[model samples]
Target: MKKTAFIFPGQGSQYIGMGKDFYDTYACSKEMIDLAGKVSGIDMYHLLFEENQELDITKYTQIAMLADELAVLKAVEEKGFSSTVNAGLSLGEYAALVASGVMTPEDAFKIVVKRGAYMQEAVPTGGAMTAVMGLDNETIEKICQETEGIVSVANYNCPGQTVITGEEGAVSAAADALKAAGAKRCVPLKVSGPFHSDMLKEAGLKLEKELEQVEIHDIQTPYITNVTADYVTNKNEIRGLLKDQISSSVRWQQTIERMIDDGVEVFIEIGPKKSLCGFMKKINKEVSAYHVDKIEDLDVLVKELSGQE
Candidate 1:
């Protein structure tokens, strides 16, 4: 079998009825959802499947997205699929950890419950995120540095796409500067907080305490870390990396490149959105990228991975 990497997306990917197909089609999917609710003390089914106001909220969105991703993951594994490596963007990291055997389902659920709540609670008002298109990371970094306040690049998503985050005024100022410096367009994102910015450092500290409670197991399958954009072979680094991830720029582009260098020929994003797959195309078009959001997508992915006769 060719080398495969299982990637999961983070927040902003969740929507109503995301994993309903998997929930209905696979018993393991339902069991994972049930376990998520039991562990998190939230109604996972209603939060995800039903039309509700809580799904978008960060605290709830984290667990909801993780549940959906894991539901689909369960079904994929049952289909006799496994990965050589794993990675996830931001909140999706927990799902990756579970898939890599670094964390059990129960432990991951427990951490996410706290992770989501901490992020939600730490979302300071007057903070914002903006997507800077057609601008190089260095230019964006320079503009953010020149601009006042705590503004910085939040996500290095692709070659020309990077997200900036900071105090509302600072982010706006930086966005304007970026556009003036030849950026295609600086679009203000509908985000609740300055995620991946220094403003959330407190949340990271809180998560560090929470991490101390969970057991970081040996890597059955090595997974990459968002903080450093490299494979995490040392189990000891898990806690610090996960804690710092909340306030660090997500080096998504670098992470994907690292995987490709390490022989990840196929990347299967198992989650609600094809966001990561979209990024993969921008990062490198030669390799194959697939997303198993629905049962039908899984069929296509299975065929692609198993190869054609």
Candidate 2:
């Protein structure tokens, strides 16, 4: 038997006009997007397609990504394919929860809208994130420790790659130190806030209050959490972990490792980009991975999975 895991992408994978093709082709996709707009009170189609590029605020970006991922998942579900396990990075985790029936799509949209808003408001403007390549986790941690100000490792993305986030000056200093310590590159990311750091504690607390209002249930399929890098089956535990995730590093590498150890021989990334697929290849070359993003990719995926291609 082929064991498969369904993984979703995080914030950075989002692009303009994602899922429009699906929306045009599938009624379910359109319905999902409509629900997203109704719950979040933002024009999903406009924000995703017609809005100016400069309007890609964190809140809108978060909602758009969630809608796209959910749209793709609905299309895949209609194909009668399911997974042994599901996992997502950061905001993507909400999509994972929805797919696993832990929460309704409407509820997930509302939570993510507030989650993104809180995260943006937590940090002042000009807060940034940077990716430090060609450095191990230990070296990155050392640099963050050595830096004077408020920089911290935010995402343990993969081996030889970690992202640091905080105040601009502190992040710059950390980048310099990482380079001095033999880093290949430290590239700043275009983002609105210092996500996944202690700087987000205020946002996390606010999100916790909102989370308490939402009802969470046990997942139909085991969902790996980004905070603990482990599978969470308990409803209450899921709520707590999601709150913690707002201010903790995204343990993506560990999550992928645990999924492989749990017998996930094939990984399917269902979202706007092949970001998770690339990460999976870096973590374990032996594991087969595929991405279904565009309508063509979806058709190809359907054929491949059905053994007709």
> For residues 112-165, could you state the per-residue lDDT of candidate 2 as single tens digits?
999989987887765779999998999899879889988998999888889999
* Residue runs of model 1 more than 4 Å from their true location after superposition: 307-309
Model 1 C-alpha lDDT per residue in residues 1-309, reported as the tens digit of each score: 879999999999899999998999899999999999999989988998899999888999999888999999999999889999999999989999999999989889999999888988999999999999998898899989999899999999989899999999999999888889999999999988999999999999999998899999999998999999988888998999999999999999999999999888989999997999999989999888989999999888767667742
Residue 4 lDDT (model 2) = 85
What would the TM-score be for candidate 2 when compared with the true structure? 0.97
In order of appearance, the predictions have TM-scores of 0.98, 0.97
Q: Which consecutive 10 residues in model 1 have the weakest lDDT in total?
A: 300-309
Scored by CA lDDT, what does every candidate get?
A: 0.92, 0.88
Displacement of residue 141 (Cα, Å) in model 1 is 0.7
Clashing pairs in 2: none
- Among these predicted structures, which one has the highest TM-score? 1
